[model samples]
Target: MTERQLPGYRRIANEVRAAIAAGEFAEGDRLPSVSALAERFAVTTGVVVRALEVLKAEGLVIARHGSGVFVRRFAAIRRSSPARLSRARWGTGQMIQDADTEVRPRVVDVVVAESPAPAWVAEPLGLTSGSDVLSRSRRFLVEDRPVQLAVSYYPADLVRGTRIALTDTGPGGAYARLAEQGHAPAHFTEYVRGRFPSPVEAGGLELQAGTFVLEITRHAFTAAGLCVEVNRMILDATAYILDYTFDA
Candidate 1:
């Protein structure tokens, strides 16, 4: 297609995106300066900036406060709803068991470590920074192929003595046990981001180097608005799509 036939910003964005896909701008590679792109595309710097914005929105590029724009490590994995994710309807404990029974998640790593919670986690869990937390990491497989990796966090005090926290059972999942203990989460708020997986996460999920991954962060809450659980789930983009439905 001719340049004049395409929208100015779109044409620029497409060219840049194509270059990135072709490995001209590999992950963590710096994109050309706005002035450089403008010169290359024979457009004004503003036009080039606008094009970069497109890339940023697509999760193809990231802008650091002091550093210039760089090719983002991962393409944004689109997240929807209605998928058969065990966590969507069940609690962490239950999800683990369901996976073992029907899906059979490959237990890559499970550790009960102590560490200060990150800001994103601390705020939701209603805990101060540096509070002790239980970190649980799980890798799941579908049809014997790696599919999803999830890291869940719970307030240590809340789960410390519970059976759900101590054992990895096959049927009575975490949420079920939580319900049994009278801390059933009635709702959840989820935050979605598009990014490439870290080297460790990528390895665990068995993702291709440049494969895009979707990050879904969820905070489970009770009817009283108390946050009960926080989880971060990473899924292979090409293997599955998150689907959801809404009623009028």
Candidate 2:
């Protein structure tokens, strides 16, 4: 297929992932170079790079320093089991408002300090090792009970001087702010992992001892493939459910 007919970078990534599963490429195999994949797929280098990133997110490949990308020998797949439904909503869409809902997110504090980000945040945002990032921590409550905590990080250079760089009020939230600044996000890929709620998170969220937390890491990208934002959203296990429709 021509590059135009090859679909987007993510589609290419999925195809490659399937090939690996089918033994087209096994563990320890060196993936084709960005340029090589571009030529083979009739796509651009940028497209190939984007594809590799998808693999990285899936924990299916590793990009070694000074060495080429290789299939992860023992990649861990953290799959979410199908569970009972909950009363909360989770997904990418407009926020649902309920008149009877007594609780709403009141901005607790908005900090605009620079600090070194954790490795997970740093790597996806393409930040240099030990680079400083603008970190914002927001707390919200439901029914006057604390329910969620979101720690968002952005490259300082991208948000240092804008109105939203250090503000509490905005339209559509952080994602919209980045888009308005000409860095519109072309895609969002999320990694969801499960863990027991932290003492702090549980205390604030009023979570019970057995409650789990779904930790989500979101990577936002520009149309040109630049990583713009990496955010961590922690949600109470019983507070949300994911819904989707499947077609045959």
In angstroms, give how far residue 232 of model 2 lies from its true place. 0.4
TM-score of each predicted structure versus truth:
0.60, 0.55
Per-residue C-alpha lDDT of model 2 across residues 48-77, encoded as one tens digit per residue:
898888787555788999899999886222
Question: Per model, how many backbone clashes are there?
Answer: 11, 1
Q: Indicate which candidate wins on TM-score.
A: 1
Instruction: Indicate the worst ten consecutive residues by lDDT in candidate 1.
Output: 75-84
Q: Which stretches of candidate 1 lie over 4 Å from their true place?
A: 1-108
Local distance difference test values of all predictions, in order: 0.73, 0.68
Evaluate model 1: give its TM-score.
Answer: 0.60
lDDT of 1 by residue, 101-121 (tens): 333445555555557788888
